[model samples]
Target chain A: MSYVVGVDAGGTSTRALAVAPDGVVLGTGRSGGANPNSNPPEKAAGHVETAIREALGALEPASANACVIGMAGTAKLTDPQVAALFSAVWERLGLTGVRIVTDPEVAFASATPAPDGTVLVAGTGSIAARIRGRRMVSTAGGYGWLLGDEGSAFWLGREAVRRALDELSGTGRLGELTRSVLAAADVDAADRSLAWRRLITVVNGEAPVRLARFAPLVSAAEDAAPILDRAARLLAELAFAARDPGESTPLVLVGSVLAGPVGARVREKLDGLDVRSSTDGVLGAVRLAGIEAFGEDFATVPGDLPRVP
Target chain B: MSYVVGVDAGGTSTRALAVAPDGVVLGTGRSGGANPNSNPPEKAAGHVETAIREALGALEPASANACVIGMAGTAKLTDPQVAALFSAVWERLGLTGVRIVTDPEVAFASATPAPDGTVLVAGTGSIAARIRGRRMVSTAGGYGWLLGDEGSAFWLGREAVRRALDELSGTGRLGELTRSVLAAADVDAADRSLAWRRLITVVNGEAPVRLARFAPLVSAAEDAAPILDRAARLLAELAFAARDPGESTPLVLVGSVLAGPVGARVREKLDGLDVRSSTDGVLGAVRLAGIEAFGEDFATVPGDLPRVP
Candidate 1:
């Protein structure tokens, strides 16, 4: 019985699935982070190998005809060292024809069977990619927090701090959002002048991307509608930037920010387009591997490609 | 023989000027950086003392009845340790009645004799200060590079890199600004895909504020007009935010960004207002010290205050 193995390699964790050619789930496995950018290349590759090994389970690894890895930081593989590390993992696992693709490509594939579409991811950072032939061909606004990352969780958290500072700068009453922000930063609001200064210091004291921790507070506050609206608008603009003019294709919205209020607003802004939400990228990886093993018609196999929940 | 001393203590250098009651420049001194936030408190205080002693020039430090220091990062002095160091500098110099104020206050005083006005500073960071009674009472957008600092040199440089990334993300023609950004980042434009990725990596590899180094490139490129215009708009908004509605007091523009093309655009946006440029903050320090020593009317003393060049 021929089978295919698929893995979704993320920053914090990695997951793998092995499936028979007939779309039967053979086994599953999970491991630690495998993103080469944040994790050491050897460790990342080791995690990928571990997950795939577990997924193979009692099934013969040599029986898998194809393997696909949907990785968050696939760009890191451009480095020869990292590429070699990942290659070594495949060799040790006795896996051949291993294909590695960006998480966005898998995300788009997970949402729809369309070969061409747009995938917008707004997790800690944000980026929009144009997918053609189930692959990310180009991207927009993935410049990280320093450059862009507009509409990202990082952007949302930074905006929350800016709002708190703005409220503290004036004599007006502090809004609920400001109060929540001050509380989150563990800064006392008794002295407005000192509060703002302290808040700035606290935010700058940590890693810049850690600012994403404040993002959840934004959505929970009643006075944070403007921030949410702006985030949605920026995210929609980013999605459109990655698409061709008037090109109507499935737009897959992935990431935590898109799963809540901001995502709803983004959907409102993109009223005309066919929008889909993809939560699990591993399923997408499985679908891609299945297609590679069973040809294009495998995409239409109902039991083979699971629906994105 | 009762002269007043004024010092402008900045991040890169410190300058001191001794002025007579009638506004005649007595002696001048210059030294290294004295910003407590960037330099050690002891070193910063020592630099301030060195500059002031040189300005006293063969005269008794006790002869100066009043001394005013216009310092960048005056907030750093709020820390007890830093304040103690500065106090020690005053005592060692045998200087009494020493007063320290923010750079914006002195910049406002340098531009005009008005007791109330606005001061906009846009160097590596950006801020707008509201001056009342010759002191900064309130401010806008001085939240540092992490939170705000909109329209700052850092903001301009960051926008330049973003523009380059945008151009590289698409297959369209690269603009002059994009080419210049690529060159400045030392990224080879041979492969558009590799160039944009390389540019982002190069930027992330450095200190966040170092992005300000690219500000000059934005001004030098003709295609960078949109970025300049947006920066001007943001700065104008910041200046207006610091002023009360219909308040017609003088608006003093300070810092290197305000001395260049971005400054020109900001001035144009701020048209119909009382606009002034203040290049020498030390002169303002002298003017303030003269006022504190002689009387409020001393502001009009022609010989006691030199024109801002």
Candidate 2:
């Protein structure tokens, strides 16, 4: 009869899962983005509430023993005003003892039962975190699109664009990658200067994060090995930087960029570590809730909760 | 009656120099920042005009045979609206046929008389350009602070902060770099967690480009050699990427990051190449104007011009 709720408040969408003590997913609900960094605090909180309410769905929200939110940019909560807004939402939901952790923590937990490990994420942005138990204790290379985020989708895409620009400017050899990027940017001119100028204009017109949109194209390119090599190396370096010299722990690879060739390359580079992939962040949140509700630090993930891999 | 004008429209300030056909320094002018990327288009244009007006002093602005304005983010002028705004300002200033070039081009021309060469700039942002016939024909690694700008002041500063965070988390060795970065961020907390959290908050509060403010601290740190090594290596790679092997041309180093230890390292990396430092961009502009006015590519830089270096 008792239940716990797990939430994944991401930049693009918010998702919630209601799970029983045994880890059975009772219900699932979704809502708009709930990232405080991207959305207004009130709106972000509202979306979180909406998703949780729908997941609860007459299951008595007050009956839920605990709630854990796996959120992107949880650092926004460091601001008192933003934290208070989120707290008010929890109060209205009739939930207490709510726990919030960074997306990387949930991801690391989702991949393995290990309490301490490393998690490398490479979606729109890239970051690597060292997880201690269920908490992200340290991190490396999460400097965002502006500063670092090397080996991220953003970096991959930016590299692809740079290659295309070089080709258009007579500095790079013409290749299939160059042709595809030029066409994608709708630059038909054979005149390199004109095409180069147009391409720059095209990129600058969009939002900075949208650079990730071109990343998949690199994966599709015939000459993607170089980019993949650099990405994997950088990601591995980040994980290594977050770990002690002799330390050995499970490394959880998460996010879209890592799920493809880049992930394989990272796995190959990190030969000594026990490598795993996070299939679903929601499952990790559910496990955390299980730990909270039953005080089962070593509880095995429920067999019938759907396979993670 | 024939004269030339050269201007450096930078993000912090604008400077202009009037040079007669015989290399006589006629007048000079200074004004606020005129970088379109940093200022409103109108304000950017106004600053440019003010600098030029002051440089003209007693000389008729229309009497100049050629005017060259070197500006940052020249790609922004690819936008028709922004270009039109700048054009209007040029018309009002009676600057007929004002020539605008990328900042790297001016930096290269300032360093050497070679019309074709490579320029490496490592200020808050980093970029390498291949200059052909006094024009920027190709470029590498100018993706701005968001995507790349490797080996720049911003990169050094961001790396220092990252190293500090690692040390605070016990994942890295506590060293001079870590201690310096911690103190610089004003993270006086004995608790590593508190200090880590506070540094993130402080960095996020400022304009991302301002991260360059912490770069100088890294230079002062005892363990700055590795950073300098990496920076110099990356810069050399950028320049090489834009140069054809076996083709020898002057390599010009410019900006604060490259003016110090990093610059020495870069110089050491390119020992066989003709590497020189760009002391004044306005001097480059003056040379370009000379080429335009006299159709002579080989004009000596004026000796009596106020010391630019």
Fraction of true inter-chain Cα contacts (below 8 Å) kept per model?
A: 1.00, 0.36
lDDT of each: 0.90, 0.82
For model 1, how does the per-residue alpha-carbon lDDT over A43-123 read when each residue is reduced to its tens digit? 999999999999898887778888999997888888898999988998988889999989998888777877899999999
| Top candidate by DockQ | 1
Clashing pairs in 2: none
TM-score, chain B, each candidate: 0.96, 0.94
lDDT (10s digit) by residue, model 2, range A65-134: 8888999878789889999998899889889889997889878767787788889888988878888877
lDDT of 2 by residue, B184-260 (tens): 77887488777876777788778778788888887788887888789889988988988888879988889998888
**Model 1, B1-309: lDDT tens per residue?**
999998999898999988888778888888999999898889999999999988888888889978999998888887898999988988998999999998999888877888999999999999999999998999999999988889999999999999898898888899998898888889999899989889999999999999999999999998999999999999999999999999999999998898999899999999999999985788888889989999887787633455422
Q: Best lDDT goes to which candidate?
A: 1
C-alpha displacement of B130 in model 1, angstroms?
A: 0.8
Segments in model 1 whose C-alpha atoms lie over 4 Å from true places: A302-309, B302-309
Give lDDT: candidate 2, residue B287. Answer: 81
DockQ of each model vs. true complex = 0.93, 0.37
Angstrom error of the Cα, residue A209, model 2: value is 2.1
